[model samples]
Target: MIASSNWKRNFFTIWTGQAFSQFSSSVLQFAIVWYLTDKTGSAMVLSVAMMMGFLPQGILGLFVGVFIDRYSRKRIMMISDSFIAVASFIMVIAGWMGILSTEVILVVLLLRSIGSAFHNPCLQAVTPQIVPSDQLTRCSGYSQAVESVSQILSPAVAAVLYRSWSLSGIVFLDVIGAFIAVFTLGITVIPELHQDENRGKVQVLREAKEGFQILRSNKGMLGLVLIGSLYTLALMPTSALFPLMSMSYFNGTSMNASIVEVVFSVGLLFGSLLLARWGGTKNRVYTIIGSFLLMSFSLFVSGVLPPSGFYVFVICSWLMGVSGPFYWGAYTPLLQSNFEAKYLGRVLSLASSIRLLSGPIGLAASGVLAEKYGVEKWFLIAGGLVLVAAFLCIMISTVRNCDNR
Candidate 1:
C-alpha cells in the first residue's frame, strides 16, 4: 500500500496531467464528429467513424493486459501518449495539406485507439498500486469529475474554434496535451510491482487464458461484466447518433448541439461531485441499478417528445449525464476492490474489450435503423433495452450479492 500522505500527491500529479490530455482529445473528437456530420450527413458514415475509433481497442485489449502485468506500466503509458501525439500530428499535416478525408480521419482514430488499448488498462492497473483500497471509489469519483469538467468545456470550445480555426489548428492542441502528459508521467514516482522472472517466459496466449480463468472464477464479477456488455450494446448506438438527433430530428444548429453537450456534461460534473462526497450507497450494486433506471427513463422520455421538444430533450440529456458517474463510479471501484492487484490489468482489459466489442454491433444496427426508421426511434429502442438489462441485474443473485461477497 502507498503511504497515506504520498498517495494523494502521486495519484493527482499524474491525474492532473491526464486531465489536460482528455480535454484536448475531447475538443478534437467534437471537431471530428461535427466535421463528419457537416460533410456527410449519413448515419452510416458516423457509425463507421465511431467504430473505427474503438474496434482496435476491442480486438487488441484482450492481449494488451498480459504486457501490462509483466512490464513497466508507467513506461507503457508514456509511450502510448507519445504514439497518440504522433498520430494527431499526422492528422494535423493531412489537414494542412487539405487532404483530410474521412478515410484519413478513420485511420487516425484507429492509430489512436491502438495506443489507448495499452494506455487505458495500464492506468487502471496503476490506481490500486498507489491508492488505498478504501479510497478507490472516492478517487474514481474525483477522476470522473475531472473528465466531466473537460467534457463540459470541450464542446463549447470546439464549437467556437471550429468556426474560427482550421482543422489542423484544432488538432495541434492534442499534440501539446500529449506532451504535457508524458512530461508529468516522467517526473512522477510510481512504485514498481515485484516482477516474477519466470512469468515472462510464459506464452502470451497461456497468460491471457489464465487471466480469463481468474475472471471466470468470480461468478458475480463475471455476471456484472456481462451486464455491462449488454448495457454498452444498447448505449453506443444512441450515443453515436446524438448529433443527428439534435440536427436532423430536432432541426437544430451546431450551437444548439453544443448546448446539449454542455448541459449533459454539467450534469455529469454535478453527479460526480455528489458521488465523491457521498461515496455512494451502501450497496454499490444498487447504486448502479438506480443509474440504469434513471437513464432508461430519460432516454424513453426523450424519444417520445415532439420535434419542438428540443428543450425537453436537452433536459433528458442532462439526466442521462447525471446517471453516468454513478454507474462508472460504482463499477470501477467494484472491480478494483474485488480483484487482486496482480490480476487487475488482465481483468480490466478483458472486460473492457468485451464491452467495447458490443459497441460496434450496436453502432452498426443503429446506423441502419436510424437511417431507415429515424434516429428518434433508436432512442426508444435503446431505452427499452436498458430497462431490460437493469431488470436482469436485479434478477441475477450473483450480481446482487457481488459487493457483499
Candidate 2:
C-alpha cells in the first residue's frame, strides 16, 4: 500500500515535469519549422528537416527498448532529458556565434530525436507499473490533455518570440525545461519490474527476437501494428506540409500559422477532457477505427476546399486534432493492457520504431509530391489512403476480433 501511494505521487510528479518539458520542446519545434518556411519557402527543405527529426526515433527505438527493459526507467528518462538539454545548449551557442547552419540544426534535431527514442518507450512502459488497469484510459486522456495544452501554447509563444527574440533564446528555454524535467525525475521513485530469482542471465538479441515472435504469434496484434504503420505513413505528409499550406495557400503570416495550430490544439484539449471524463467505450479498437475514419474524412474535405475556404480548413484541422487523441488514448491503453509489463518495453519500443519508420519515408516523398501535385492534392491523397487503411482493418478478422481477445 505504501508503494502504491508512492507510485501515485511519483506519477504526478514526473507527469508535471514532462508537461513543462513538452511545452518548451514544442515551442522550439514551431520556431524552427517557421524559420525554415520563412527562409527557404521550399517544401523539400521542410521535409528533410522533419525527416531528420523523426529518423532517430525510428532507427534507435528498437535498441533503446531493450535497454529500457533491462535498466531503470527513471535513469533512462533523466539521461535522455539531459542529452536533449546538451544538444539544445549547443544549438544556442551556434545561433549566438551566427554560424547556425542547416546542418547544425539537423544535427541537434537528430540528437533530440535520439533522446526521445530512449525516453518515450520507457515512459509508456512505466505507466502500467504505476497506474491501475481501470484508470489507464483516463490517464492516457489526461496525458493527451497536458500535451494538447503545450501544443496550444507553444505556437503562440514561438510566434511572439520569433518576432523579437533570437532562435537561441527559444532554445535556451528548452534547456531550462529539460533541467526541470531531470530534477523532477531525481525526486521521484519509479518501481522496477523484478526478474524471477531463478532466471538465468538474459540475452538482448534473443529477447528482441522474442518480442517480434510475440507479435508474430498474435495475429491480431500484428495486424494492428501493420495498420498503425500505415496510418503513420499516411499522416506524415499532411502534418509536414501544414505550415507550407498555411503560408502559400492561405496567404498567411507566421502568426496566422500559429493561430491555426492553437485552434487545433484547443480542439485536442476538448477531446482529451471528454475522454478523461467518459473513459471511452469498452471496445477501444472500434474507437481507434472510428477516429481514423473521422480524421480521414476531415482531411479529405479540407484538401478539396478552395483557398478562400481557409475558415473551413480551420474546422477540419480541429476535427483532425480531436480524432488524434481519441485514437491514441484508446490505442496506447490497449497495448498496455494486452502486453505483460515484463516485455512491454521491447514490445512497445519495437512497435514504435516500426510505425515511426514510415514517417521519414512519407516525409521524403511528400516534398516531391507537394512540389509536383500541390500541397492540397497531397492531403487528399493521404486522406484517401488512410481511409482505405482503416476500412481494411475493419474488414480484417484478425484485427477486428482483437478487442474481444
Candidate 3:
C-alpha cells in the first residue's frame, strides 16, 4: 500500500502522465472522425465507426474484470497502454502509405477500444489502493477536471494540426503519450490485491458471475446502477443532438455550435474544480440527486426556448455540463467506498457496460425522433425521463442510505 505521506505524490504523478495520454488520444480521435467525415459524408459510416469504438468495452466489460482482479493490475495497465501505442503506430504507418482506408481506420479504432477495455478498469481498480478512501471523491473530481481540460483543448488543437500536419504526425503524439504513461506507471508503486493461490483454478466465467452476484446481492447499489443507466438513456439523445439543436432549431452557425461546446466544457472544468474543493455533501447521494434535478431543469428549459433564445440555450448547456461532475464525481466514489477492492473491478466494469450499452440505444432512437418530430422535442422527453428517474432514486430507501452501509 502507498504510504499516507506519499499518496499525493504517487497519485498526481500517475494522473499527470494519464492526462498527457488522454489529451493525445483525444486529438487522435478528433482527427479520425474528421478524416472519416471527409472521406464519407454518410452518417451511417460515422455511427458504425462509433460502434466499433464502444462495442468491445460494452461486450468485454463483463469478462475483463475477472482478469483485472486476478492478475497484476499494474502489468495490465502497462500492456494496455503498450497495445494502444502499437495500434496508433499502425495507424501512422497506414497513413504514411496512403493506404489508410476507412476499413483500416475502423480496425485501428477497434484495437484501441480493446486496449481501453483493460486499461480503464485497471486504472479505476488501482486508485483506491494508492489514495486514501476519504479522498476518493476529491481525486475523482480532479481527474474529471483533467479530462475536461483535454476535451476543451483537443478539438481546436486537432483542427489546427490536421490542417498543418499529416494525420500520421498527429497520431504519433499518442505514441509518445502512451510511452510516458507506461514509464510513469513503471515507476509508481501500486499495491496489488491479495489473491488466493487457488484463484487460478476458478473459471473466468464463474468469477465474472460471482461479481454479478455481489452486485445483485446489494439491492441499493443495483438500484443506483439502474438509475444511472436510465439517466444515460435519457441524456444520450440530447447529447447526440446538441449540434443539431444549435444549428437547426436555433438557426445558428457552426461558430455558435463550437461556442456551445466550449462553454459546456468550461462548465465541466468549473464544476470539477468545485467538487474537488467541496468534496460534496456529507451524503454524496444528495449531491447526485441535486445534479439530476439541475440537469433536468436545464434540459427542460433548453427545449422550451425560442430560436431567439439561443444564448439562453447556451447557458442551459453550460448548466448541464456543470451538473456532470457532481453526479459522476459522487457516484464513482460511492462505488469505490462501498465495494471491496477486489470486487470493485467487476462492479465498475458491469456498471460501465450497462451505461455504454444504453448510450447507443439512445443514439439510435435520437436520430429517428429528432428527424420525424424535432430535435428540441427529444430534449423535453429526455428531461422528463430524468426527472422521473430522480424521483425514483429519492423514493428508494436503500439507495438513499447506500453510502452509510
Candidate 4:
C-alpha cells in the first residue's frame, strides 16, 4: 500500500494533474492537426510537423530519463508543464493575431514534445516510488483509464468547440488547461527523494557512462525492451493507417475517420478496464503473445474483414479492442514488478523513445503507400508482418520466459 500522505499528495494529485494536462494536450493536438490539414491540405506539411514533434522524444528521451533519475521527478514534471504552458500561451496569442504559420506551429509542437519527453520518464519513475509494487498494475490501469477518459472527451469536445468556437479557441482552452495542471501540481509534494549515485559524480559524462554500463548489463530487462520496441514497430501501422483506410475503403466520410478513432478509444477503454479488474496474474508473457496474435489475426484480412457493413465493422473493432487489455495488463505489470526503482525511468524512457521514434515513418509511409496501391493492401502487408513477428516472439524461448525474472 502507498503511504497515506504519499497517496494523497503524490499519486492522486500527480495523476489528476497529468490527466488534466493530457486532456488539454489531446485537444491541442487535434487543433494543430486539424488546422494544418484544413489550411494547407498538404500531407507533406503534416508529415513534417509530425516528424518534428516526435523526433525529439525519440532522440532525446533516454538521456532525459537519466536526468529524471538524477534529479527530482516532481520538479521535472512541474517545470516541464510550466514551460509547455508558456509555449502554448505564445502559440495561442500568435494564432489570434493571425501570425501563426505552419512553421511556427511545428516549432511549438516540437518544443512541447521536448517537454513531454522530459516529463514522461519522470512521471514513469515517480509512480513506483509512490505506489506499492503489488498495486502497480491496478494503478497503471487506473492511470490509463483516466487518460482514456481524457481521450474520449478530447475529440468530441474539440469537434464541438471547433464548430461553436474556433481553432484558436481550442488552443486557448488548451493553454488554460495546461496552466490548471500546473496549479494542481504546485499543491502536491513528493514525500521521499530518490537519490542516484550518479548525481554526485563531478562530470555529467561520467554519470552517463555509468548509466549506460548499468543498462547494458541487464539482459532480461534488455529483452523486454526489445520485445516492446519490435512489437510496437511491427504492429503500429494499422492504427496509424486507420484514417486513410477508412477514407479509402470505408464510407469515405469524415464520420468514418471519427468511427476509427472512436473504435480505438473504446478498445483502449475496455482494455484498461480489463487490466484494472484482473491485473494480469497468470502467465503474463503468454498473454502478451496471445494479445499480439489476436490483433494480427484480426487485421490479416484479404480485402476487408468488416464485410462492408457498419455492424461488421463494429464487431471487428470490438474484437480489436480485445487485444489491448491482454497485452497492456501483462506487459506493464511485468516491467514494474521486476525492475529496480532507480533504473525504471531510464529503462522506460529508452523503450518508449525507441518505440515512438518509428511511428512517423510508419505513419508517413503508410499514407504514401495507401495513396499508391490502396489501403487494403497496406493492411494486408502490415498485418502479415505483424503476424510473423508474433509467431517469432511466441516461438522464442527468451520471449516466452519473459516473466521468469
Candidate 5:
C-alpha cells in the first residue's frame, strides 16, 4: 500500500536521478582504478585518486554548508550536476586523444570533487524537506537500494567497456548519466527548503559556530559525532583497499576484482531492501550500534576468509554493504532531527569534514600496509581495531544513551 503512495513517486524520481549519476560515476571510478593499475602497476596511484576525490569534498564541506543553507538547495544540485557533466566531457575528450595520464586523472578527480562539495549537502538537505520525518528511514533506505543497484551494475559495465572499448567511450557514457541527472532536476519542481527564522539575524561565523555550540550543548549529538567519527576511522581502510584486495588476494585479476565489488554492492542493495520493507528500529542509537557491531564482525571475517573463492569473498564484501544503510539511515537523520533547521547544513558539513579526514590517512595507510604485510593482514588489523573501538563505544554509558533528541 505504501509503495503506491504519491510520496513514493516523487521519491522514486529523485532517487532515479541520483541512481543514474551514481551509476556513471561508479563505472568511471572503477575504470580509473583499473586503468591506473594496468598502466602504472602501483597501488599508490589508486590511493592518490581515491584520496584526492574525497579530500576536496571534505575540505569544502564547512563553507559549502553555510552556502547551501543560504541558497536554494535544488538550484545548487542542478548547477553541480552541470559542472560534473562539463568536467566529465573534458575527461572524455582528453582520453580520446590518449591524454589520460595519472596527472589528468588526478585533475579530473579534483574537479569532480569540487562539484561534489555542493552536491552532497544539497542532496542531504532535500531529503528532510521532501520525506516526512516518520518516513525518513524508508526514504533513505530506498535511496540506498537504487544507489546499490547502480553500484552493482555500473562497475561491471565499465570493466567490460574497458576490455572492449576505450576510456573515451566510458567517459562519454558517464557524461550521459550526468546530463540525465540534470534533466531530472530540471523537470522536478523543488520544494521550499526549511531554514531557521533567526537565520537572517545571525552572522555567518556565528551561524557556523552554532553547529559546534549545538554539539557541545547536546551531549547525545556530541557523543554520536565522536562515536561516528571513530567508526569512520575503522571503515575508511576497507574503502581504500577494495581495489588492492582484488589484485593481491584474488591473484591479480581484474575480472575477479569487479566481481568482488559487484557482490559487495549487491549486498548493499539487499540491505536497503530489507530496511525499506521493515524500516529501522525507533531506538536509533541501538540500531546504529548493532550495525557497527555487524560491520566489525564482517571486517574481521573478510580478513580470515579465503580470498580465492568467489562466494567467500562476495559474502565478506556483502557484509560490509549490509552494515552501511543502518549506519547512514540512523546517522544522517539524527543530525537533521536533532539540530535547528537553520543549522542542519552546517552540522552535516561538519560531520562531512570529520569523516573525510579519515580518507587520506586510511587510503595511504592501507596501501602501505597492503604492500608490506599483504592485504589479508591489513584487513585483520583494521577489523580488530574496529571491534575495539565499537566495544569501547558500547561500554561508554554516555555514547550508549545518545538519542535522536
Candidate 6:
C-alpha cells in the first residue's frame, strides 16, 4: 500500500509549482529563439545562443547533485526559481530601456540555466520521496503530460503574443509565473535526504567521486546512463534546428513553427496519458529501445522528404513526440527503482550533466554542418546515430537487462 493518503495531495502541490515554472520557461524560450532567428537569420548564432544557455547546466551539473543531496530540495527549488525570476527582471528592465543586446540576452539565459542546473536534479531526486514505488511510473507519465501541456500552450501563446506584447511585457508575465511557482513550493513539504553523523566529512570532491562510484558499482545503471547520453547527443542538435527547418526550408513563419511545436506536444500529451493509464510494458528497457527506434525512423523519414513535405515533417514530429514519454517515464522510474535513495540525487545529476555536455559537442558540429550543407542532412545523421545507439543497447547485456535491475 502507499504510505500516505496525502501523497497525491503533496505530489500535486509540488507538481503544480513545477507546471507553472515550466510554462513560464517555455514561453521565454520560444520568445528568445524566435527573436534570434528573426534578427540574425544565421544558424551559427542560434547554436551559440543555445550553447550559452545549456553550457552552464552541463558544467555545474557534477557538483549540483551533491548540493541537492545535502540541502533541502524545497529550498533549492525556491532559490533557483527566485534566481531565474531575478534574471528575467533584469532582462525586462533592459528590454524596456532599449538596452537589451544579444550579449545581454545570452547572459540572462546563462544565469537562468545555472539555476536550472540546481533545480532539475533536486526535482527529480525528490520524486521518490513522495510517491509509492509502484506509482512512480504513473507519476512520471503524468508529470510529462503536464509538461507537454505547457509546451503546447507556450508556443501558441507566444505566437499570439509575439506581435502584440513587447519583450518587456512577455518577460513580466514570466516573472509573475515564477512567483506562482515559488508560492506553490512554499506550501508543499518535500522530504529531504538525511545525513549520518560521524559518517560524513565536508569533502566536495570525495562526495562527488562517491556519486560516480555508485554508478560504477551498478554496471547496469551505468550502461543505462551511457545509452541515454548517446541518445541525447543525437537528438539535441536536430531539435535546435527545428525552428530553422520550418522557417527556412519550408518557407513558413513563426506561427507555422509554433504549429509544429503544438502538434508535437499534443502527440506527447496523448502518449503520456497512455503511459499514465498502462504504466508501460513489463520490460521498460525494451520500451525505451522501441521508442528510440521509432523516433529514429521518423526522423530519418523527415530528413529524406523534400521541402514539399512540410506536412510530412509535422507527422514525423508527432511520432517522435509519442516516443518521448515512453522513454522518459520509464527511464526515471528505472533509475529510481534501481538506485539507493541516498545516492539517487547524485546519480541523476551525473547522468543529466553528461547528457547535457554531449549536446554542446553535437551543437558545435551541427552549427558548422548545418551552415554548410543544410539542417535536413543533420536530421538524417542524428537519426542514424540514434538508431545505432539503440542497437548498441540491445547488444549490451547490462543495458538490455536494465528493466530487471
TM-score per candidate, chains pooled: 0.93, 0.90, 0.98, 0.90, 0.88, 0.92
For residues 180-297, write the lDDT of model 1, one tens digit per residue.
Answer: 9999899888888786752647578988998899999989989999899988998887876787899999999977787887888899999999999988888799999999999999
Candidate 1 ranges beyond 4 A from true positions: 34-45, 93-102
Per-residue C-alpha lDDT of model 6 across residues 1-405, encoded as one tens digit per residue: 225887898899888878887897888888888887887788778767877888899888887778777777889889999999999889888877889888888889889989989888888888888888888888999999999899888876887777898777888888888888899889876666667831555577788899999878879878888888888888887877888889998888877787787788899998899999989878788878888999899989988988888999999999989989999998889888888778877888888888888887787788788899998988898899889878987898888887753
Q: What's the TM for model 2?
A: 0.90
Q: Rank the candidates by lDDT, best first.
A: 3, 1, 6, 2, 5, 4
- How much is the lDDT of residue 272 in candidate 4? 80
**Model 3 agreement with the true structure over 1-405: per-residue lDDT tens digits:** 578999999999899899999999999999989989998997888888889998899899998988888888899999999999999899788877888889998899999999999899889889989989889999999999999999999999999999998889988899999999999999898888886742647587888999899988888888998999889999877777888999999999989999999999999999999999999988888899999999999999998998899999989999999999999999998888788888988888888888888888888887888889999989998999889878978999999888852
Error of 3 at 48 (Å): 0.9
lDDT of 2 at 25: 94
Clashing pairs in model 3, backbone N/Cα/C closer than 3 A: none
Which regions of candidate 4 are displaced past 4 Å?
A: 1-9, 194-196, 201-206, 302-311, 364-372
Which candidate model has the greater TM-score, 2 or 6?
A: 6
Candidate 1 vs candidate 5, TM-score winner: 1
Q: What is the C-alpha lDDT of each candidate?
A: 0.89, 0.84, 0.90, 0.71, 0.76, 0.84
Worst 10 residues of 5 by lDDT: 1-10
Clashes of each: 0, 0, 0, 0, 0, 0
**How many Å off is the CA of 70 in candidate 2?**
0.8
Residue pairs with backbone overlap in model 4: none
Top lDDT model: 3
Q: Across residues 204-261, which tens digit of lDDT does each residue of candidate 5 receive?
A: 6766676667667877677777777667776787776786777777675767776777
Candidate 6 lowest-lDDT run of ten = 193-202
lDDT of 2 by residue, 300-391 (tens): 99789887888888888899899888888987887777787887888888889899988777776787888998889888988988898789
